[model samples]
Target: MASASSSIIPPPQPPRSSSYSYHVFLSFRGPDTGNRFTNHLYSALDRKGIRTYKDDKKLRIGDVISDELEKAIEESMFAIIVFSPDFATSSWCLDEVCKIIECKNKLGLQMVEVFYGVEPCDVRHQIGTFREAFQKHERKGFHESEKIQRWRDALKQVTAHSGWTSKNHPNL
Candidate 1:
C-alpha cells in the first residue's frame, strides 16, 4: 500500500495600501430592488466620495460572473447587500452573497446588510417566503449541493451580523 502525501500552500495576501476610505460592493436582486434602492444607494455612496462597484446597466441573459464583477468584489473593502422582498429568488444573488462571505472570512472585509422591505427575523430564521423560495430551489435541483449550503451559510452569517435596516438607522 502507498501512503498519501499532502502539501501546504500559503494563503493569498490582500492588498497593502487602503487607498479608499470605503470600497463598496453592492449586491442586489434585479427585479426586486435593483433599479429603485440599489441605484439610489450607489448614487449616494458615490456622492459621499465612496468608491462603489455595481453590475452593468444592460440586462443580458446568461451574463454571469464577469471579470469586472470579480475584480470589484476582490478589491472592495466592504460589501453591502440590499435585501428586498424578492432578493432570495435569484440564484445569482445567492452566489454573490456566498462570495462576499468568503471575502469577509479570508480578507477581513466588512459587510452591511439592508433589509429594505423585509423583517430581520424572516432572514434570521429562514422562515416565511424565504423558506419557501429556498425549498423550491432545492426541489428544482439544488438540494445536497455545496453551493446551496454556502448560500444558506452566507444568509445565516449576514443575518447574524450587526448592520442597518431600512426601518432603523444605526448611529454612524
Candidate 2:
C-alpha cells in the first residue's frame, strides 16, 4: 500500500523574509467591532509606535485570506485576535485564525485574544454564537468537513490561552 504522506499535499508557506515589517497582527470581525473596539485598539497600538497589520482596509473583498494577508500574519511579531459575536461567521476570519495558530506552533509567534462582548468559555467550547456560526457552516455544506474542523480546532486552541474578555469591563 502507498504511504499516506505520499498523497497528502502540504500547506503553502509564506515568502521567506529575514525580518518582519510589523510588530503585531490584529484579527477581528470588521462589521461587528471595527468602528469601535478594533479601531480604538489599532489607534492605541499605532500611537505607541507599534507597527500593526490590520486587514479591514487592506484586502479587497475576497473568498479567502490573500497571499498578502498570509505574509502579513507571518511577518508580524504577535497576533491579537478579537473574538466578537459574529467572528466565526466569516470564513476568511476562521482561515486567518487557523493560520495564526499554525504560526504559533511552527514559528513561535505570540498571540493574544480579546473576547469582545463574548465569553471566553463560549469560544473555547463552541457555544452561543460560536455554535450558531458553525451550524451555519455545516448547513451550507460548501466547505469540506476537514476545513471546518480545522476552524473549530483553531478556536478551541486559541481560547485555551490566557486572554482578555469584555464581560466584566464595561469601560472597555
Candidate 3:
C-alpha cells in the first residue's frame, strides 16, 4: 500500500517594502464619529496608497487590552487623531493618544489632529463641550486617573502643533 504524500509549502512572509506612503494610526471614539468620519478617512487613505491601522475586529469576551493594537501604534509612522466631543470621554482613546504622544516625543512619530466638529481652542483650553465631558467623567470618579491628565496634556500639545482644522481649513 502506498502512503499518502504531503507537499510542503513555504510560509508566507511580509513584504520587504510596504506598499504605502505612510503608515497611519487612526485614533477616534467608536460610538461617536468612529463609524462615519473615521471610516471615510480610512477609505481615503487607502485610496492614496497610505496604509492605515484601525481596530475593526470585535474584542474577545474578556479582552480588556490588545497587544496587537499597541504594536500597530508603535510601528505606525503617523497618528491621526479625530478630536470630537466624545473623544475625551473614552479612557481607551485617551490612553491611545498618550501612547501616540509618547511615541511622538520619544520615537519621533508624526501626528495630525482632526478637530472633526470642534475648535482647536476648545481642545487647548479644555473648555466648552470638552470641559463638560471631563466634568461628567470627574463626577463619575474618573477624574483622578493619570490617563485623564495625560489626555488633557496631549490635547494641549496637539493644539499647539500645526495641523488642519475642519472649521477653518481652506481645503482638506
Candidate 4:
C-alpha cells in the first residue's frame, strides 16, 4: 500500500469528459484490504487530485444497498477491482462487478484489475477459494441461478483484461 503507482504500473489518468464525476471507483473486499492497501490507494488518488469514490459500505450486505451505487459506477470514469482471497466470497461484490461491467460496456468506462493476493487465472477459472465461494453461494441459494451465472461471467470478463497481480508485483 505504498501508493498504487509504487506497487504496479499506474492506471491511466482520468479523461476530461464532463460526464464523469469521479476519476476512479474502488471495489474491494473490506475485511481483506480496507484498512491497509485501499486506504493508501485512496490517499494516493487524493494526493494526485483525482476524485475517487471509495465506499466502505459498498460491499456490505444490508438494506443500505441501493441504486445510488449504480449511479456511482456509471458516473465514474474508471474502476479498480482489487481481487483478494475473500473477494469472491461476498455476493455484494459480485453484484457490484455486474454493474461495473455493465457500465464498462455501455458507457465506455474503463477498468483496472488488481489481483491483490490471488491468482488471475484462479479468478478467471473460479478455482481454489473462488470455487469454494461459488459453491457456498449455490448451496445457500441466496441469489438466483441466473444471478450467479452473471457473477461467473463477470469474473471471466474481468480477468480477461490485462491486469496487475501481486504475484508479479509483490509490493502491491
Candidate 5:
C-alpha cells in the first residue's frame, strides 16, 4: 500500500506551498463507496502521484475524533466528499462534513463534492435518502438540536458549490 507521500511524480500546482502534507482529503461513507467508487478514485489519484488521505482506520463508536482525521483535513490542500445514498445516516460522516466545511471557511481549504449515485438537489434540500437520514437523526436525538442544524447548514452550503455527478461526469 502506498503511503500518501510516496510518489512517482510531483503533485499538480495547488494554491498552497509545501506545508500541505496531502493533495486531497477523501471523505466518504465507508460502506457505500469504500470498496468501489472511493477506492477506485483513491487508486487513480495514487497512480497520478496525487498525495491523498483516505481514512482506512476502524473508528470507535464515539464522536469523530478531532485528532488524526481533523489533522489530515487541515494538512490537505483540498477535500473530495463522496456523497452517496447512506452518507447522511452516519453521525461520524456528517461530523466530518461539518469539519470539512469549517476548514473550507476558516483555512481557505478547497472542496469538491462528488454526488456518487446520488442527487445534489436531494442533498441540498435534504430530500429522499437524505431526508430519511435526518428524520432518523431527529428521532434518535443522539445529537443536540443545534448540532443537527449545523449539519443541515453544512449540507446546504456544501451542495451550493459546483460539482460533478456520476451521471454528468461519468469519466471519473
Candidate 6:
C-alpha cells in the first residue's frame, strides 16, 4: 500500500475529543447492496439515534473521494464495512476502505466487517470476485500502481480483524 498524503488524511485529530460527530460510518458498494442490506442497516442505525454517516448519493461528484467523505470517516467513532461481492470493483469503495483502515490504525477508531454473502477468506486472500476486481483494475491501466497495492493491503488488514461471516447462515 502507498503512503497516504496530508491531502488525503484530515488534519490532526485531537487526542482527547470524546464528542464524535457520528457513531458509525458505513462503507459499501452502492450498486450491490445500497437498496437492500445497507439501507436496512442505515434505517436501523437511524432508529437507534446512532448518528451514522451514509454518503448521500446526491452529494457525490466524482470518481475520486471527496474531502467531506474523508472528514466524515475521521469524525466517526466506528466504521462498518459491508463487504459485498462487487465491493472491490469500485475504486471509491476501495479508497473508503483504505481510509477506514487509516483511521483505525492512527486514531484507534473501531471497525467491524459484515461479510454480506461474501466469504471472509475470499476477501483476505483476494480470490473469487475480489480476484476478478483486481484483474479488471490491472487491465484498465488507469489507476496508479501504488493505489492498487494499497487497496490489496487494506483488504488484507481489515479482514485480519474480528468480523462476522455469512458462512453460518447463507440466508442472511
Among all candidates shown, the one with the greatest TM-score: 4
Alpha-carbon RMSD of each model: 12.3, 11.3, 12.5, 3.1, 5.0, 8.3
lDDT of 6 by residue, 87-149 (tens): 999988899999999998888777778888798999999999999999999999846889899
lDDT of 4 by residue, 1-172 (tens): 4355444435455553666777788888989988877888887777878788888634355635547677788889888998999999998789889999998888778888988889999899999999999999988985687888999999999998989887875665
Give the C-alpha lDDT of model 3: 0.71
Candidate 1, TM-score vs. the true structure? 0.77
Residue 147 of candidate 3: its Cα lDDT? 57
lDDT of each: 0.70, 0.81, 0.71, 0.82, 0.82, 0.80
Candidate 1 colliding pairs = none
Candidate 5 worst ten-residue window by lDDT: 1-10
lDDT of 5: 0.82
lDDT of 2: 0.81
| Candidate order (lDDT) | 5, 4, 2, 6, 3, 1
Candidate 1 lDDT, tens digit per residue, 88-153?
A: 878878888888888788777677777877777777777787788798899988876887777888
Off by over 4 Å in 1: 1-22, 57-67, 169-172
**Selected candidate, larger TM-score, 4 vs 5:** 4
Least well predicted 10-residue stretch by lDDT in candidate 3: 1-10
Model 3 misplacement above 4 A? 1-22, 57-66, 143-145, 169-172
Residues 1-172, candidate 2: write the lDDT tens digits: 0222112212324534557887788899999999988888887777657688898756677636568778989888788899999999998899999999999898877788888999999998989999999999999984688998999999999988877777766876
Span of 10 residues, lowest total lDDT, candidate 6: 1-10
Per-residue CA lDDT of candidate 3, range 17-129, in tens?
45433478888888877777677677766665667787774235565565656767777777888888788777778778778888778767777777877888888998988
TM-score, cand. 2 vs. native: 0.85
Which pairs of residues collide in model 2? none
Better of 2 and 5 by TM-score: 2
lDDT of 1: 0.70
**Higher-lDDT candidate of 2 and 3:** 2
Model 6, residue pairs in steric clash: none
